[model samples]
Target: MESEIDRFPVKSLMERYSITRSVLYKRLKGLGIVPTKFGRQSYVTGKELTLLDQLHDPNCNPRDVNRWRVD
Candidate 1:
């Protein structure tokens, strides 16, 4: 059987990235990332977090998540 992938809560991501809910949602939408819902809460997979990190700009402000680019 395949091992379960690590999951992170959206609230934790907000704290980790220092972004607001709207900003996080916008960033996720821009990046074509869809959060997995569990009951009333939302979560992101480790793979998705990696993708976010890969696209993240260290120099840019955390709130400026739009600065992240795929290309």
Candidate 2:
């Protein structure tokens, strides 16, 4: 992603990830993520996409996350 590319549409992202609207919002919200607020057009940043990837990644481990630290 580049500085010029600020965000991605939530619907397209949902389609790519096979996520439902409620699931997408719930997951993103739980991870402290939010989209840019506009009139009838919400969108998430590239940073959010990266974060989402990390959270949903098959290779991610419980110990890899600082917030969910494990002994």
Candidate 3:
């Protein structure tokens, strides 16, 4: 099981990425990233967060899924 420290809530992710909830979910869906559910809340793993950061990085190529190390 993943520890709490390794998980980030959806709301926090929105703030961290400076995006709205709709945009965040849309990006995640486009990236094929499904957030884990904890009761009524949703979260993304630390690894996913790293990928998200890269996805939003101006210097990175969003189309390069193989380089993301998502698996």
Candidate 4:
């Protein structure tokens, strides 16, 4: 299968999520998704972004979040 995702760089993620770098890292850590490193920049997959959305959405149940978590 193709591995690449519609990834976003750290700067764009920060702007899109309105989160600081520290918070972004923490959230990524919580989701168990590793960011792809390119030189000094870090990028996250669209799948990861969806997980973050579920995590932050008040309408989403906590159990639903766990279903998508990476090993």
Candidate 5:
């Protein structure tokens, strides 16, 4: 049993952070992470983000983060 964090849309992030689309794009670029696009929009995988965060710390690279890509 584990808690699941959901994926967030680009527009949702823009509104939540009170930032423009360009700013969001810039931040993503600065972070060196690219999202996987599904359908006609872009999306950030919450699991991937968490995994990256853990990996970024250099001392906590976890073996797995819960996520399944349906295709």
Candidate 6:
């Protein structure tokens, strides 16, 4: 199980992936990954980030990510 410390803010994700906010959000939508939002901040876990990384990979088909589970 992942601890709370492993969670990251959406802004950090944007920077780590070197993607624009719009692009990241759009991909998140397409991937069906809804981040936990608290006020102005959005949180994503390391597991979720791994999935997102796969989704961001140019060679990985988005459709192939259906096998990924949050757990």
lDDT by residue (tens digit), candidate 5, 1-71:
99676676666766765668887666566555577778987777786455444543546423332232112
Q: What order do you get sorting by TM-score, best first?
A: 3, 4, 2, 6, 1, 5
Q: What is the lDDT of residue 71 in candidate 2?
A: 20
Residue-level lDDT tens digits of model 3 in 20-70: 989898778766778899999998888788779888898877677555544
Better lDDT candidate (4, 5)? 4
- Over the stretch 9-45, how does candidate 6's per-residue lDDT look in tens digits? 8888888889899988877776677899889988887
lDDT of 2 by residue, 1-71 (tens): 64655788777767877878887876666666767766788887777777777867878763444463112
Candidates ranked by lDDT? 3, 6, 4, 1, 2, 5
TM-scores for all candidates: the values are 0.67, 0.68, 0.73, 0.68, 0.57, 0.67
Q: TM-score of predicted model 1?
A: 0.67
Over 4 Å off, model 5? 47-71
Best by TM-score: 3
For candidate 2, the clash count comes to: 0
Worst 10 residues of 6 by lDDT: 62-71
**Reference-based lDDT, residue 28, model 5:** 61
Predictions: Cα RMSD each = 4.7, 4.9, 3.8, 3.9, 8.1, 3.6
Give stretches of model 6 more than 4 Å off: 1-5, 62-71
Q: What's the CA error at residue 14 for candidate 5, in Å? A: 0.4
Q: How do the residues 1-71 of candidate 1 rate in per-residue lDDT, one tens digit apiece?
A: 88765888877877887878888887788767788999988888887787676545676465555555343
Cα TM-score of candidate 2: 0.68
The per-prediction tally of clashing pairs is 0, 0, 0, 0, 0, 0
Q: In model 5, what are the clashing residue pairs, if there are any?
A: none
Off by over 4 Å in 2: 1-4, 61-71
Show the colliding residue pairs in model 4. Answer: none
* Residue 31 lDDT, candidate 5, scale 0-100: 53
Q: lDDT of all predictions, in order shown?
A: 0.74, 0.69, 0.79, 0.76, 0.58, 0.78
